[model samples]
Target: MGKLLSVNLAVPEPNPAKSVGRTGINKRPVDGPVPVRAPGPKHGGLGSGLVGDQIFDVQSHGGDDQAVYAYAREDYDWWQAELGRELPGGLFGENITTVGVDVNGAAIGERWRIGPDVVLQATFGRIPCATFQYKMAEPHWVKRFTQAARPGTYLRIVEPGEIRAGDEVTVVQQPKVRVTIAEGFRALMLEPALLPRLLEVEELPEEDLAEIRKRIARSTRQRD
Candidate 1:
C-alpha cells in the first residue's frame, strides 16, 4: 500500500522534438480531486484519462491500456541523485506521483484502488521516447533510462472515479502472473529472450502480444 503524492496535469508547451509542435509532457501538480476514466483508444480518442490532463502524441500514447501513468517518488529520488538535479512529479509526463509504491515491481493485471473509488490495473511500463529525451535535456537519456530499468507503470482505469493527492493506494487484486512491469519493459526493449514469458500475462495489450509473437517466430526461424 502506498499514497498518492500528487496529481499532475500536463501544461502544453512547444515541442520541437515532435512534428506536432506541441507536447503535454510539462506536467504540473494540481490541487484537488480529478476525474479519471478510460479515454477509449489511442488515435482519435480522448488523450488522457484524467480530466484537465493532455496527451499530444496520439499515435504512440494514450488509450485504454495507458489511460493513466504513475511514477514512484522513490524512483524520482534516485534520478535526482543520479542526475544531480531536481526532478519533480509529472516531469516524466506521469499523471500520478506515488510514494512508497513499487510501480515497476507491480505485476501485470494487478489492480490498485486509489482513494476510494478509482480502480486502476497495471498494464505495462512506459517506453522512453524522443519527447522524454527532449524534456530531460540529458545526454543519452533514452539509453540511460532504459538501462536503469525503473520505468514507471501505465495503468488502465478499471472503475472510473475521482482521485486526489493524499489518497491511499491499495492493491485490491494481484494477478498470478510472473511478468512484472519491469520485466515487461526489459522484454520489449532490452532483452528479446524474455518475450516468451510475457505470454503468461493475459492482460497485455494486443499490439504488444502481437509483437511478442512475431519476435518469437522470428527467433524460432533463425534457430532452425
Candidate 2:
C-alpha cells in the first residue's frame, strides 16, 4: 500500500511548429478529487482518466489496457538525481503519482483500490516513444528510457469514482499469476527470450500478448 500524492491530467495543446505531434504528454497536477472512468469502447477505447484529461494519441496511448499511467515518487527521486534537476510528479506524463509503492514491481492484474470507489488494475508498462523524446529534448531518450528499464506501469480502470491526493492506495487484489511491470517491460522491449513469460499474465495488453504469442509460435515452428 502507498499514498496517492497527486492526480494529473493530460494537457493536449497543439504545437504545430514543433514535431512533438498532437500529444497530451504534458500533464499537470491538480487539486482535490477528479472523476475517473472508462472513456468508450469503440474507436480508440475508453481511457481511465480524469474527467477533463485529454488523450491525444487515442489509438496507441489510451485504451482499456493502458487506461491509466502510474509512476512512483521514489523513481521520480531517482530521475531527479540522474538528470541533476527537479523532476516533478507529473513530469513523466503519469496520471497517478504514488508514494511507498513500487509501481514497477506491481504485478500484472494487481488491483489498487484508490480512494473510495476507484479501482485500477496493473496491466502493462509505458513504452518510450518519439513524442516523449521530443518533449524531453534528450537525445536518445527513447533508447535510454528503454535501456534503463524503469518504465512505470500502465493500469486499467476497474471501478469508476472520484480520486484525490492523499487517498490511500491499497492493494486489494493480487492475481495468482504475477508478471511484474518491470518484467513485462523487458520482455516487450529488450528480451525476446522472456516473451514466453509474458503469457503468464493474462491481463496484459491484448496486442502485446498477441505479438508475443506470434513470436513464440514462430520460434516453435523454427524448432520443429
Candidate 3:
C-alpha cells in the first residue's frame, strides 16, 4: 500500500510578479530540495508561515499519489469555480508522493521508514498564508484552506537516502497524542500558547521537538 511514486523539486528563481511580495518560483526541478540562494535570510529565502519547511512546507509533501488519492479534487474544483483557477498540486511541495497513504490522517510525529536510508517524519500540518493566495491567484485561499482544514500535510527528512519512485513507505511510529492536524492548525492560529505544551512531550522525535521548541520561543518573544 505504501509505495513512492515520484519525486519533484521547485528551485525558486526571481519571480517579480507575485502579489505577496515574495520572489520565488512556485515549483521547479524534478528532484531534491529547491535550490535556495544565500545572501538572503539566515534560513535562506524561504518565507514565513506557509512557505518554508519548518512551518508551512514539507521535506517532501506531494506527488501523483497525493494529487490523485489524498487531495480533495472536489474542493479543488470548487476553488476553481470560486477563483476560476486550479489550486496548487499537493500540500507542502513534497518531492515524492505516496500511494495508499492517508496523509491527512497520519498522526503528528509519525515516521515512515522508506527503504533502508530514507525516513520521513510527519512533523506538522501546513498553515496556509497570503503567498498561497497570490500563487493561486485567489485572495481568500487561506480562509478556504483553513475552512476545509483537511489540507494534506508536511514531512521532515529524518534520514537521507537515494529515494526514487515506487519504493514502499512503512510507518515506523504512530504518535499517541490525540492532537489532530486540524487541532494543530487551529492552535497555531488561535492559541499559539498550546504549542509549547504539545512540543514538550517526549513522544515527539528529537528534530521535531527541536523545531517546536524553536517556534515556541520565537512566538513567545514576539508577544513579549
RMSD of each: 0.9, 2.2, 7.9
Query: Candidate 2 has what TM-score?
Result: 0.91
Which residues of candidate 1, in runs, are more than 4 Å off?
A: none
Best by lDDT: 1
**Tens digit of lDDT per residue, candidate 1, span 124-218?**
99999999999999999999999999999999999999999999999999888758999999998899999999999989988778988999999
**lDDT of every predicted structure (CA atoms):** 0.93, 0.83, 0.50
TM-score pick, better of 2 and 3 = 2
* TM-score per candidate: 0.97, 0.91, 0.59
Angstrom error of the Cα, residue 113, model 3: value is 1.4
**Which pairs clash in model 1?**
none
| lDDT by residue for model 2 (51-150), tens | 8777766566777777788999999898778778888888788988999888999998999998779999998889987677777777788898899888
Cα misplacement distance, residue 148 of candidate 1 (Å): 0.4
lDDT of 3 by residue, 66-120 (tens): 1111232344455567667554534334444556666667776677776656666
Best by TM-score: 1
Q: Report the error of model 2 at residue 124, Å.
A: 0.4
Candidate 3 lowest-lDDT run of ten? 60-69
Cα miss at 54, model 2 (Å)? Answer: 0.5
Q: Any idea what lDDT model 1 has?
A: 0.93
